[model samples]
Target: MSADPNPHPTEPDVRPHVYDGIREFNNRLPNWWLFTLYATIVFWVGYWAYYEWFRVEPEGARSVELAMTRIDAAKLAATAAVNIDDKSLWAMSRNPVFVDAGRQTFEANCVACHLKSLRGKSESPTAIGPDLTDQIWIHGGDPTDLYRTVTQGVPAKGMPTWGPVLGPKRITEAVAYVLSHHKEGEPIVIDTSVSAPAK
Candidate 1:
């Protein structure tokens, strides 16, 4: 028996080209599907131009950076609003919440130089930082002095300024943590033997 030339007379015609044993049907795609594909392409082009090329809108990274800048500014403003002095710092040292947070910050960033005990050179001769627990202070022994020293840093003594890195809040917390080891009325002995390292 011979096979029929037109398998389905009502269906669309097949393409002349055949690959292996398969033949492709020469049928036009539905308008809806074509429209969707074209629309997606156009949308992609517009999105790329808006975000990548033209930069009309901020992308993911830029958005995050802008958010961070705003947050930093807000934090600085809040810190500035609060009155920070010797009495205030002493009060913070007495508060367990502030001290605990300060301890976490100190352990994370200060342990490398100051050691976990915060005894620094007193605990170990090889320690780079000075003893934080000692009553003797190379810089100044007042609570405000400590805060100033931590913020400004002793560059000549190899201490990096932590104000910019930790921000005012964290630095205040860290100072409170250090102050927790001492009493408010304790005698402050200034160590005159060790001067600032020669510039």
Candidate 2:
């Protein structure tokens, strides 16, 4: 007798397990879901290899860096040029455009000692320094002398050396402004007076 060709395949074990009646089914993931998961993993690996793991020197790095440096220098130079032109001696006096600038400078640097209104300190007078609003001259009343006084300073009278700080053009403006203040119809009186030295 020939054995039956259609023999039943061995039945898969389906023993029911009971642990307080809670049961878990042991089933493989669906083909479509498994394939999707595998594709996602593959895509992640490829992206990591291409961007992070790969080593490639960026193109145009050198030229781009050099161009950025030049642009910064040009911007700085433009701003510096404008500042220098605005503060020039001719621009400050004859131009009449920078008078406000000169006035601002005076208010910042001189107001503390000279007073905001260009009036000499009335409460406690400084014997060494001359009262600024007075027509009585300590330094010569000329613009050149006044400029020299501001730039060189009267060390004997405790004035600071404003030349290195204020520069030439600023010094001229500050002096002119001070001189103009004296002639504005207010003569300040002091205990003692000294003649200004010639420039």
Best by TM-score: 1
lDDT tens digits, residue span 89-141, model 2: 33345434455566777898987677766665543476334456666566655
Candidate 2 regions exceeding 4 Å error are 1-96, 122-129, 182-199
Per-residue CA lDDT of model 1 for 1-199, tens digit only, reads 9876777879869899988989999878999999999999999999999999999989998899999999999887887865579999999999999999999999999989999999998999999998999899989989888888888998888788988899888988999999999999999899877865554
Cα deviation in Å at residue 196, candidate 2? 9.5
Highest lDDT model number: 1
The worst-scoring run of ten residues by lDDT in candidate 2 lies at 82-91
CA displacement after TM-score superposition, residue 39 of candidate 2 (Å): 51
lDDT of all predictions? 0.90, 0.62
lDDT of 2 at 35: 97
